[model samples]
Target: MGIHIIKMPDLGEGIAEVEVVEWRVKPGDTVKEDQVLADVMTDKATVEIPSPVNGTVIALGGEIGESLAVGAELIRLEVAGSGNQNGKTATPATATATAGTTLPGSPVSTVCERAEELEEAPAPVAKAAPAQAPLLKAAPPRARGLAAPAVRQRALELGIALEFLEGSGPEGRITHADLDAQLLRRVKVAPSGPKPSDPTDAERTIAVTGMRRKIAQKMQEAKRRIPHFTYVEEVDVTELEALRAHLNGQHGNQRGRITLLPLLMRAIVLSLKQFPQANARFNDESGIVTQYDAVHIGVATQTAAGLMVPVVRNAHKHDLWSSALEVARLAEAARAGKAVRDELSGSTITITSLGALGGIVTTPVINHPEVAIIGVNKMVERPMIRDGAIVARKMMNLSSSFDHRVIDGMVAAQFVQTIRAYLETPATLFID
Candidate 1:
C-alpha cells in the first residue's frame, strides 16, 4: 500500500561506489525484514545489503555488474501503511513486476509447493528447461528453481540442471545442502554399464564482476604504472627442508606443524632488515616513495572465488610458528570469505607461490603501490657438484620482481640473495 526506498549503505573506508554482484530478490519477490536483498562488491570485499522492513520488491535499483554510487537508491519496495517516499501509497494497478511475475493471491507459491512434492517422491527424470528461461516462475507443474549465486555457480560447475532438482530452503530455494543431496543421489544411482560419451558444445558467458573485476582493474593499473623487472635465483633448500621436517616432527602436537612458508617468511623478515627499500610503497601521483620499518607481508592466496592477498601484519614481531599460524589463519579466512577489510590491505611487500605447480620461473606482478613481489617456485631434487663431487640437493628458484623507478637492479638481486642465504643456512634464521 506504501512505497519504501532503500539506499545503498555506506560501506566505510571512503568507498564512494560499489558493484552490484547479485540480487537475491527481484521484482514481485516478497522480502522479510533482515533478509538480504543484494550483494555488492567493494574494493576489498563483498557486502550484503539487508531489508529494514518487510516488503514486496517493486523495482531493482541497478542491473547485475553495474556500479552504484553511495547513497544511491538500491531498491524500491511496496510496504504496509505510509512509506519513506513522501508517505506515498503504491496502487496495485501501477505495481510493476518482471520475469517471475506474481500477482496477489496468485498460484506462484503453489508451483513451488508442487516442486517440493516431486522432491519427496522417488528420483524422477525431469526435462531440463531452456537456459534463458526465468529461474523462478509461476508456470504450472514445472516452475523453475531458485538458488543463491554461490549455489548456482557450484551447480554450473557440476553440470547440474537446477530446474531438475528441488530446493529445500525457504520458498524452495536451493542450497549447498541440496547440491550435496543431488550428488549423493547421483552416486547411488550410477549404472555399472559402460556409458557412452555425450559431449556437446555449451557456451557460457560470465560477466566480469565482483572480486574478479576488482582484481582485473588492480592488475591493469599495476601493469600500466610500474615498469617491472624480474630477477630469478636458484637456491639449495635441502638444509631448510630438513630443518622444517625436524621441527615439525619434534613439535607436531605441542605447537602447530611447521611449513616451508613460515621459514621463508622468517627469512624475508630478516632480509627486510638489510634492504628496507623493498619494504615500501610508492605514490605515483605525488612521486613519493614511503618506506616502512615495520614489515607487513601480503601472501597471495587463491580462493574459490578468485585471487586474494591477505596481509600478515607486523611480520617482524612474530616468531616462525607464530608467523605460520597467522599466515594459515589469514589464508583460511580469505578462502572462507570471512576476512575483514583491514586484513585484506596495507602490505609493504607481497609474496606469491604456486607450491608444486610453480614451474621453473615466474615474473610476479608487483602489488601496486608497493615496489616488489617475491615469487617462490617448486623444489626438486637435482644432481649438483658442491665440493667437486656429484650429489643430490633440493633446489628451488626465487623469482622476484621490482619496480625499476625506485629500486635498482642490484638492490633487487641483493634482496632475493639475502633471503636465499637465510634459507640455505637454516640455523641463521634462529640466530637473530
Candidate 2:
C-alpha cells in the first residue's frame, strides 16, 4: 500500500493559479482511476481534476472559492498499487471525459498530463490587460417575500426587486423560474437601461464572487483594451428559411432538428474562406495577428449560470445536417453546464444569437484576442419591394463588432457583405 499525492497540473499556458470551485470527493470516499475529484476554474474555462489512481481519498487541498497555485497538492490518496512510490503521477489516457454533473453550462475536462508536461510547456505568448471597469446595469431590491437563499441570491444579481414577486415553491417560497421570468421581462426594452442605484432598505446585498466576477473582469478588459467598430446589416432569409424547412423535412427523424444557427454558421464559414482577416486573433502585446486555417466558431449561449460560449471545432468540415447536430449537441451541453474545457476555447471567430428572441441590431463586443464577433437578431416578417411589387418577407439583421486595430472598415464591410450574399442565395452554401 502506498500514498499518492495529486497536484494540480498545468491548466494552460500562463495560468499559474486556479480557483477550486467544487470538490467531488470527500475524505474516506473510495474513488476509481480517472474519476473526477474536483473542479478548478481558470481564466479560459473550468477544468475537472481526475484522480490518477484507484484509491481512497484521505484529504482535500482547499475549500470552494480557494485559489491554489499550479503544482500544489490538490488531493491526497491512499492507493493499493505499486510504481507510484517514486513520487511520479500517472497520466490518464488520451480519451478525456467531460463532467457536467458539477457545474452545468461550464466545460469540464479531465486533466490528463503529468508534472513534467507543465515544465516542458512554453509560457503563454500573449497577454491582453483589462482596459476599463465593467459597466453594470441596475439590479432589483431583495425580495422581502418568501424565497429560498438561492432564489434570493439570483434575484439580487439580476437586479430584480423581488418584494412583490409571487412564489411557486413550497409554502410560498420563491423559485428559480420566477426569477427568470422577472429577468426576461426586464430584458425586453426599447433602449439600454440605466445603472442600478444603491441598495435600499428593502434590498439584500449579495456579494459579487465566483464566475460572475470573472465574467465582469474579462468583459471590461476586452472593451477597454480593444478599439471596437460595429457594423449592422439586414439580410433577406425567405429562401433560406424555405430551404431549411425542406431540408429538415427530408431529414425527418434521422437527425436532430435543424435550426437557423447552423445555416448561418455554414454561411459564415464559407465567407471566412474569402476574408480570412475576420477569422483571426490579434495579440495586443506583440502587435501580431495570427490567422487560422481551421474555423472554430464560438456560439454564445445564455444559461442558468450566466453566459457561456462553447466552441464548435472544425465547423467548415461538417455539412449542413452535421453542423446542425453539432450545434445542438454543444448548445445542449452548455445549457446543462456539462461542456468540456476544450469545447470552450480556441474560437477564431464567434456567432451570438438570441434565437427567436433575437432583437434588431446588437453591437456585440468582440471576444478579446479574437478579431470579430457576428450577432444574430430576431427575424421579423415585414413588407418588402420585389420585382416592382410590395410583398411580405421574413427579414433579420446581422450585427458585427470588430477590433478596429486589426480589421479595417472596408474589410469588415466586405466580410459581412459576403455573408449576406451566401445567406441570400441558399444554394451557394452547398457548393465548395
Candidate 3:
C-alpha cells in the first residue's frame, strides 16, 4: 500500500485560509471516493472536503478549529497498488465539495492533478495515534432498541444508551418520545431532600469555534473600527398594520400571507432613494464609500449555529408579496444552514428585528462596511391624544445606527423620518 494526500483547494474570492470545523473520518477508518472527509469554514460559508479515491484514513493535517492555509496538506490516506506518494504528493484537482454553495472557481471534477502547480511544499506529516479497537461490532446488540437515525444521533448527543430504554414507537421502535420519558423519569427520581443551604456551582467551558468564532471576530472589528451613532424614532404603524391585515385577508387564499417585514422592506427601499448615503458600503482603510442604486437588504437572522445575515438582492424590484416570499425563503435557508455564499454576502445595508422579543429601544451595531443598520422593535398599542381625543394607536420604535464619520446626525434622523412617514401613511410605499 502507498500513501495519498489531499490538500486544501483554493476556494477562490481571495480566501487565503479556512478553519477546520469537523472531521468525518479518523485514522484506520475506510472512506470511499466522493465521501466527505472534513468540513472547513471560510469567511462566507462552510465547505466540505471529500475523498477523491477510496482509501483508509491515515492522518489529519489539523485539529478542530485550526486555521489551514490554502494548498496545505489536509489529510493523508493509504491506498492499494502504487499510491501517489513517492517523496512527492498527489493532490486532487477538486478537493472541495461545498456544503450548500459552490466556490467561485473550484469546479467539482474527477480528474487527478499533480501538486506541482501549488508552490507550497508539503508540510511534515504529524504522527497519528494508533486507532483504537472497536468495543462493539457493527451490528447493534440484541438488547439495543430499534431507533431511527435521528433518534440514535440525539441519544448519542444526550449520552443515553439505547439498550437501557423501552421503545414506544411502532414495532417497539425507540422514538424521541421514549427518550423524553426516560429523561423525565430520571428527573423525578433525583434526590429531592435538601441537605445543605449551598448548592454546587457548575460551569461549562465552550470553545468559541466555527460560525460563532467568525461572528465574534466580525463584531469586534466593526465596533473597533466604526464610530457608531444611534437614532431612535417612534412610528405609528396602526394604519400600516390595518393595511397589512386587509391585504392578507383579501389575498390569503390566492397568494401567500404577507408579514410586516415586507411592508418595512418596501419603506426602507423607498427611503433609500432620497438618502443614498444610507445604502452604501464604506471602506475605512481606503477611505472610500461606494453607493449602490440597487438595494440589497441583509436580513439578520438568528439560527441554531449563530447569527447569519442573508441578503435579499435587488429588493427594489420586488413588491410586497414577492418580497415576503423571498424573505421567508432566505430566512428558512439561513436557519437551516443551507444558504449559499452569494445569499450570505453583498449587502449594502442591513435590517435586524427580534419580533416579539424586540424591546422598546435597542442600540444596534452597524453591520461592518455598511453605513447603517435599521432595527425594528415590537409593536404595542398605547393611549394617545390625537387632535382632541385620547385614542389608542399602535406604536413601534425604529432603532438605527449609522457610521458617525460618514453620516451626520441630521441626515440619519431625516432618513429614519422618511421611513416613518411611509410606514405611517401605508399608501406612499406604493406610489414610488
- Candidate 3: global Cα-lDDT? 0.84
Question: What's the residue-level lDDT of 312 in candidate 1?
Answer: 96
Q: Is candidate 1 or candidate 2 better by TM-score?
A: 1
Residue-by-residue lDDT tens digits, candidate 1, 129-241: 88899767666663457876656866887899999887654456675556656776776675688765755633334455678867876887798899999999999999999
Question: How well does model 2 score by local distance difference test?
Answer: 0.79
Task: For candidate 2, write residues 1-432 as lDDT tens digits.
Answer: 676878889977877667677799987799999999998888647788898789987677665655566786688777886524553333221011112233332223233334457679986778775788686788965445776554566577677777788754334556555665565566554355764565552333343344665676568678878999999999999999999888878884797678888889999999999999999999988989999989999999887766788899999898877887788888898777678778888899999988787788788988888999999999999999999999999999999999999899999999999999999999999898
Off by over 4 Å in 1: 87-204
Q: Give per-model TM-scores.
A: 0.74, 0.67, 0.74
Clashes of each: 0, 13, 0
In terms of lDDT, the best-performing candidate is: 1
* Models sorted by lDDT, best on top: 1, 3, 2
lDDT accuracy of residue 325 in candidate 3: 91
The alpha-carbon lDDT assigned to residue 178 of candidate 3 equals 65
